[model samples]
Target: MRLRIRPASRLQGAHRVPGDKSLSHRALLFAALAEGTSRLSGWLPAADCEATLRCVRALGIPVERLGPGDLCVHGRGLQGLRAPIAPLDCGGSGTTMRLLMGILAGFPFPSILTGNAQLSRRPMERVAEPLRRMGAEVHTTDGHAPVFVRGGALRGLRYRLPMASAQVKSALLLAGLYAEGPTTVIEPAPSRDHTERLLAAMGATLERDGEGVTVHPGPRLRPLDLHLPGDPSSAAFLLAAAVLIPGSAVRIPGVLLNPTRLGFVEALQAMGAPVAVAVEGEIAGEPVGTLTACAADRLGPLEVSGPLVPRMIDEFPIFAVVATQAEGTTRVRDAAELRVKESDRIAALAAELRRMGARIEEHPDGFTVHGPTALRGAVVHSHGDHRLAMALAVAGLVAEGGTTVEDAGCIGDSFPGFVETLQALGAEVEALEDPPRP
Candidate 1:
């Protein structure tokens, strides 16, 4: 698939993005572990979340699609999940495979977890090593996927995370639910807390004190209805478009405003982008709100590092695009995690953006962008990465000529209606099926 984007005068309007992908994945998984039917509205029905749904059903959990982005998951209780007859294929979702590994570790059954080529390369040992410590027999091909697990008696242990990863922490917590004692995860820095928040909302016995979170073995989880907010990550590209294009103003409604996930928005504000937030309320312990962004007269370069990296880890690709139009230099450090994503994002971003005339330098941990460069359109590759595809498209909006993105079908992995949403905001973008190869 190819996406052709042309320079646009402006992007102006209001739009709502898909449900928060992170929350959607957690909602479905947690719902399946509850004691009764759990209703979820505004769930992201993207490829990634679908992988979780498939795996949940494979475990004998009945999941019914009530409507578009709506679902009712019949909870199978903590001990009710049955052994699957076949290997669980997680497709390209690392979240599905990693978090599910934690849950599968507690079940007294053997299970195999695998995914597509991209996921197969992602390191699963971060998850497997900890599960092994809890008495689950976990094996992986090298450090990658095709993770095999044989459930056994689990004894909770206090483990300090080597790296700050929400998936790793969530996996331990989920496995903790079945351990003989309390399972505690001590983090050097905080990661996204969707797993912690949702678990607590479902009546799991969990506690958070500073950098440590502990979960006690729970008898059962209480099912609850939830309405998820629009994904802030998905909303990020649109917000960037509004900030970079002259005369552009956009209002995005009902976006997840979890403080842990607002690093990107905060970065934009730091760089002089007119970004504002109006808190709507809280749902299932996660904050919900509307975000408004407008083009800035001048955007100064900013520094991104430390604890902020985990908060906006997924947003850096687009952040690189925004940096190209800002004054001075933007430095991003302490984001080595980018190396292990769907693609090596730091390298991919530097290479692809350079094709479009941006001054970017790749580093071991992150990258540096020197900006206010006059960008010209050029063909860029997605490397089968969805976020890179969207970020490249946003770059196209500001380039001098038509920009083409190859292998863009992968965008469906996270943001299904990305192109349509951009068009609605007045961007000249078109999606082509099987365009002639060069």
Candidate 2:
């Protein structure tokens, strides 16, 4: 697919992105492990979350879709999931693959997990190693996908994370649910705590001591009545578009305001972008809020590193778009983790934005953008990454002409209504069928 983005005069209006993708994936999985029926509202219906949904069904859980983002998952208690009759296809979702490996590690059965080409290339050993510590026999194809797991009795574990990863942490927590005794995970820095929040809300006993989080096994997780907030990562694109185009103003409501996920918003504010956040209430132990961003007269440079990297890890692509318009150089360090995402985001961001005429210097860990440079519209590619596709679209809004992003169908992986939201905000973004080639 191709997305044609014409420069917009300004973006204006209030719009909401999809429900939190991380929370959505965890909600489905946690719901499936509960002792009763779990009703989830505002769950993401995108391709990534669908992989988790499909896997749970394949494991004998019955889920009913009441509406577009509403689901009723009849959880089959922690020890009740049946063995899958076939291999579980995880699509292009590493979250689904990794988290399921943790859950499946506790069952007394064997399961094979597979994915598409992109997901197949992603390393799974980070998750596999910890599951192995708990006595689950896990085998990976060269530390990548086509993961095989033979579940059995698990012993409690005490492992410190080499890197801060919400996915890896969540996997260990889920696996800990079936372990004998307490499973403790220590983090070097804080990552998103959605899994811990959701697990605690579902009646799991979680003990927190600074960077160490321990999950005590044996509680029957209760069903959840959840109303998830909008995705902060997805909301970053629209808010960024508002900040980039002069005279633009936009509001995104009901977004998850987890402190760990607000690094992008904080960075934008520090760069002199007119971004404001207001906490509205709490939902299922997670904060829900609204974010408003307006075009700034000038944006300063950004230098982000240390603990903040993991907070906004998923938002770097769109944040890079915002950085292109900031005065002086914007440097991103401590984000080598970007290399292993759906695509090598640092390299991909630098290459595609350079095509639009932004001056970028790519590095092994991250990249630096010497910006306030004029961008000219040019055709780019998404590298089959959803975040990169959306970021490129935002960049097109401020470029001199039309920007075409090829292989952009992957936007549906997270933000399905992205184009429609841009249109609602008065941006001219159209999804076109790609031209055939010889």
Candidate 3:
């Protein structure tokens, strides 16, 4: 795909982008697990969430899309799903694979879960090992995808994650749905808690204590009324665009600010991006706010290291590029999780960011990008990573001339309107069909 961008005129106003992707997934899944209808507004109609919707619907949840980005679900209630006639395919969504495995663990029959090639290659052992300990019959290909979940009969226990993973945490918590007693999940390094919050909202007994959280099942869940907030992760791109362009300020309205998920915002602010939280409010227990991203001076090179990596793991590639405009070196570590995200993001980002003239070093876990480089446009590959593709496209916005992204179609998996949204903010972005290869 060819991206043609020139000097962009400044953006001076606010724009509302799409709803939170994380909330969208949880809303659908939690609603499916609840006992009645869940009315949700502001769902992102992107591919990943749709993949979740599809999988749940296969198990008897009536997920209805009411126009663009709005959905109403007829929930199955806890333990209400009948066995699916086929193996549910999540198709590149680990969110569906891991989370659903937990939900299915307590049902009366057997359920099999699978994903597309990329997701299938991801480590399911994170969830499999923990659920195995909980007395749930779970099997994987040594530790990867194609997990088979045998339902009925479970024992809840305390399990601390060896790593910080919302997926893993959510899996154990979901299994706690039908466990004999309280199922405790202690994450030494915390991950996103949208699952916990949404579960609690739906009448699931979930509580947090410091770095740990616990969930208890057998309580009847109230049907949800979901009004999704804006996706901060989605807005991060346009925010970066507005900040990079001099004399620009773009305001994203009503974004979710669940504490564990706000690492990207904190990282950018720490690096000196002029960002502010505005329009603060609460909807269904998740904090909602608007983010103001403005053009600013050079940012100090920073470290996106440590336990925070899992919270903002999906945003690291673009965060790395944004690091390029800052002075000093940006160290991204403990993010070995990136190796399995959609693609091997660490290697993919290091290799493709190099195509755009970024100075960087790579480790098995993560990469360090030494920035303040004058980036130039060149041919780059997405390696089939959605965020990496969009991150590289963002780099093209400031490159001399522009850049061409191979397999740019991957962006559709997450932020579907990424090109259009940035273009509206005065970033000259054009998407072309991938040209013929030699």
lDDT of 1 at 204: 90
The local lDDT score (0 to 100) that residue 114 gets in candidate 3 is 84
Q: List runs of model 3 lying over 4 Å from the truth.
A: 7-9, 435-438
Model 1 TM-score (2 dp): 0.99
Model 2 worst lDDT run, 10 consecutive residues: 429-438
lDDT values for all models: 0.95, 0.94, 0.82
Candidate 3: worst-modelled 10 consecutive residues by lDDT: 1-10
When 2 and 3 are scored with lDDT, the better candidate is 2
Candidate 2 regions exceeding 4 Å error are: 435-438
Per-residue alpha-carbon lDDT of candidate 2 for residues 119-139, written as tens digits (9 for 90 to 100)? 998989999999999999999
Candidate 1 per-residue lDDT, tens place, 1-438, comes to 899999999999999999999999999998898999999999999999999999999999999998979899999788888899999999999999999999999988999998999999999999999899999999999998899988779999899999899999999999999999999999989899999998988889998888999999966899979999999999999999999999999999999999989999999999999999899899999999999999999999999999999999999999999999999999999999999999999999999999999999999999999999989999999999999999999999999999999999999999999999999999999999984659
Candidate number with greatest lDDT: 1
Cα-lDDT of candidate 3: 0.82
Count of backbone clashes, every candidate in sequence: 0, 0, 1
Model 2 per-residue lDDT at 197: 91
